[model samples]
Target: MSETITSDEGTLIQESRVWQAKGWTARVIKNEEDDGWAVAMYKDGEAEAALIGPWTMGRDKKNPKPLDHNAFNTLVKTASEFVRRHEQQLHASLNKSLMLNADDTDYKICLQIIPDEDDPHAYLSAFNNNGEQIAKIKVRPDFKLNPSSAAKWLEQGFQRLD
Candidate 1:
């Protein structure tokens, strides 16, 4: 059996095929897609891995290279960056803003999507040049906010939306 080390924090396993430290885990597993090895990086408390990639073969060319401090640090950096980019992209998709002019006054219009699994919806809001919210109303999640639509909505006095 492999040695198991523990501290006040959590389990810290440094073995030939698995490593866990610093709130992340890297495991070497047989690649199901080919006759090679793959490494998976998992964030602590997460059921699924955050990143997976090919692993280099060891001297024997039959086993994976043992996880080391340097390799694990690199894996953690790469995985963290990947997760950050994914979150930024998701945020961009969920929230959007645009500017339009109505009645000779400049206004900023924003549409934020609420991705509730049970009752997904969105809110369309208009703010004046002073950044004061002028109007806000519940809109469909798929509401398209373009110059034409926003201008029409403003023309209609931000009334009940369809």
Candidate 2:
């Protein structure tokens, strides 16, 4: 239901929800000090955001460019493409931490991949049910888990060696 627009200044501004079904929403705020707009994307039921970034600005300084029909259409296309790429990256990261036990409920493991500066790799964190971190793995953006490792984990399950 929400949409994103890229300013002529090469900044990507998003003014829509990430997903209508998830109820995740976002708004673009212009920084007065800097000529940049900050996008805050948050889920409806959560206080924190799912994603945030700076949108590029448009060319021509006389007046802020308006979102006309053509501009709106182009913006939607560009923004959707960005969101799709991000979603794919997230999915690939999660797949690296394959679920061990399909029925066990006592121990739970989840993976979180966060982007970092100075490096293109994503910081992967393995967490336990109590939210305690189990392991941190720095993986390349395009890295994929070996099938053998995934199978081994599935058979052995997770252990709290810590």
Candidate 3:
């Protein structure tokens, strides 16, 4: 049985092979692909582990190293950074922005994607230097959001995109 401890820091489980604290859980498991060990790091409330990597073998060379405060902290830091970078990449891919000068007025054009499984789409929007929205229209999710497309849209006076 696994022992659970609650304290000022947070809920913690410091078993030999399992450690949970700081909104993360680290589990040591046998690597199916080889006769070695692996560690899985899961963020709290998430069903799937965020990271899985090779684990160091114990002195006996047949078992995994026991989880400890230092090892668990390092795993939490690595997993948290992994999840953060993934989120940033996803956000960058789904949302984009550019600046252009039209009629001597600076304009900011942005594209935000809505990935609905049934009806995928995106919103193309423009704002003036004053931060006031100038135009917005729904466009296909696959709509290209690049300098050429943005210039074309600006040349057309931000008309509804087909």
Candidate 4:
């Protein structure tokens, strides 16, 4: 049996096979492919495993090695990096931004894609140096957000592109 831990966000964290850590849980489960064992690392509140790897066999050559603080810490770091990379990739895919200087003023142009099944679209927006919104327009999901494209839109008085 394993002990369950929870986070402050009301998320059911990891099931500690031996030692538990904050915002993380480690579990040793039967491998889905063969009769061997595998270790699973789960982040607090997430419904899916963040990292999964083969469990090392113990010195006895009969069972998996027991979890310890050192092993758990290493798993936490690896799993955290995995989650961070995933988030960065998702952000890059869904949003694009560019900064342009015109009339001695810097403005940030952003395009956010909303991939709704019924109606997919992208919202193009601009903000001044003060972070005040200048204009926002709904455009095609495939709209490109780049320096040249943004400069053209600014030259066109921020009008909707047909």
Candidate 5:
């Protein structure tokens, strides 16, 4: 099921049914942007989103093709399935891998994923032993983290002063 919501910007957004998982929830928002519309899947009630991407544009540019009975039904099915797959992958990558290492006091590292608003990438930040940031990596969510790179950083043992 989906419902239309008016955002603070006064844009009319059609929101999909909420998909909930461990520590996270996702919902697809349609008609939320000027370019076309977007699907934003984020943690429940959080202002900062984990993921937000543009939805497919309709054939007509001026006006979106009306959602007829068949179209609306098909869209609901397809979008829901896609959201399910995305939720699973996001949970596995973020919840499983990224964390603050407490084992090595001299080389303590913290990893964070910050989603960008104007871009389709996430910013990965690495902080060192003193809780100071050392490096920032721009990564696509689909990009796999190179284990070699992580290992090399550990070997170098550079403590981030700031």
Candidate 6:
């Protein structure tokens, strides 16, 4: 029978091979590719696992290391960083921005990608100095948003095209 214990953030199940804490869950399972073990980390309420990698065996070499306080804390830190970096990368890919130094007006131009299975889209928007959106236009999915590119687009009356 698996033992369940209440942790500060979540629960720990020895038999089921799960350590849930700090809005994340670290689960150890048998590696399908070989006769080894792997650990999967999932964010709270997320269906997909965020990270999965090999797990170290205990001293006996036949079982995974127990999820003790130290191990659990370390796992939480590693898993948290992994999730953080993944989020940063996702944000960078989906959204981009650049500053405009036009002679009469300054603006911040942004391009945000809206991903959809059937119809992917993007938006090119410009915000004035007061953080007010002055112009927003729906653009193609693969619009390049960078300093030089944004400047050129703005120079051409905010019309972006290849």
- Residue 4, model 1: lDDT of 68
Please, what is the whole-model Cα lDDT of each candidate in the order they appear? 0.90, 0.48, 0.92, 0.84, 0.49, 0.81
Q: Estimate each model's TM-score.
A: 0.91, 0.34, 0.93, 0.76, 0.28, 0.79
CA RMSD of all predictions:
1.9, 13.0, 1.9, 3.5, 12.1, 3.1
User: Could you tell me which 10 consecutive residues in candidate 4 have the lowest summed lDDT?
Assistant: 9-18
Best by TM-score: 3
Distance from true location, Cα of 51 in model 2, Å: 8.7
Kindly list the per-residue Cα lDDT of model 2 for residues 59-96, writing each as its tens digit.
76422333334444444455556668988987875555
Of the candidates shown, which would achieve the greatest lDDT relative to the real structure?
A: 3
lDDT of 3 by residue, 75-114 (tens): 9999999999999999999999999987899989999999
* lDDT (tens digit, per residue) of candidate 6 on 26-128: 7888899987899887888899887788988878898887665566578778878987898899989999988889988889999999998899999999998
Compose the digit string of candidate 5's lDDT tens values, residues 1-162: 445544553433343334343334444455654757654545545677555555555577643333333443444555456668988887655622333443554433333344546765544456666677777655564444455445555555533211
Q: Candidates sorted by lDDT, descending order?
A: 3, 1, 4, 6, 5, 2
In model 4, which runs have C-alpha deviations exceeding 4 angstroms? 1-21, 32-36
What lDDT tens digits, residue by residue, belong to model 4 across residues 1-162? 354545564534333354456677788887889867788888867779998999887788767887876888898899899989998999999999989999999999999999999999999999999999999999999998888999999999899877
Q: Report residue 102 deviation for candidate 4 (angstroms).
A: 3.1
Task: Count clashes in each candidate, considering only residues at least 3 apart in sequence or on different chains.
Answer: 0, 8, 0, 1, 0, 0
- TM-score order, best first, reads 3, 1, 6, 4, 2, 5
**lDDT (C-alpha) at residue 93 in model 1:** 98
For residues 1-162, what per-residue lDDT tens digits would candidate 1 score against the true structure?
255689766668887788888888899999999989999999999999999999999999887888887998999999999999999999999999999986689999999999999999999999999999999999999999889889888989988677
Residue 25 displacement (Å), model 3: 0.6
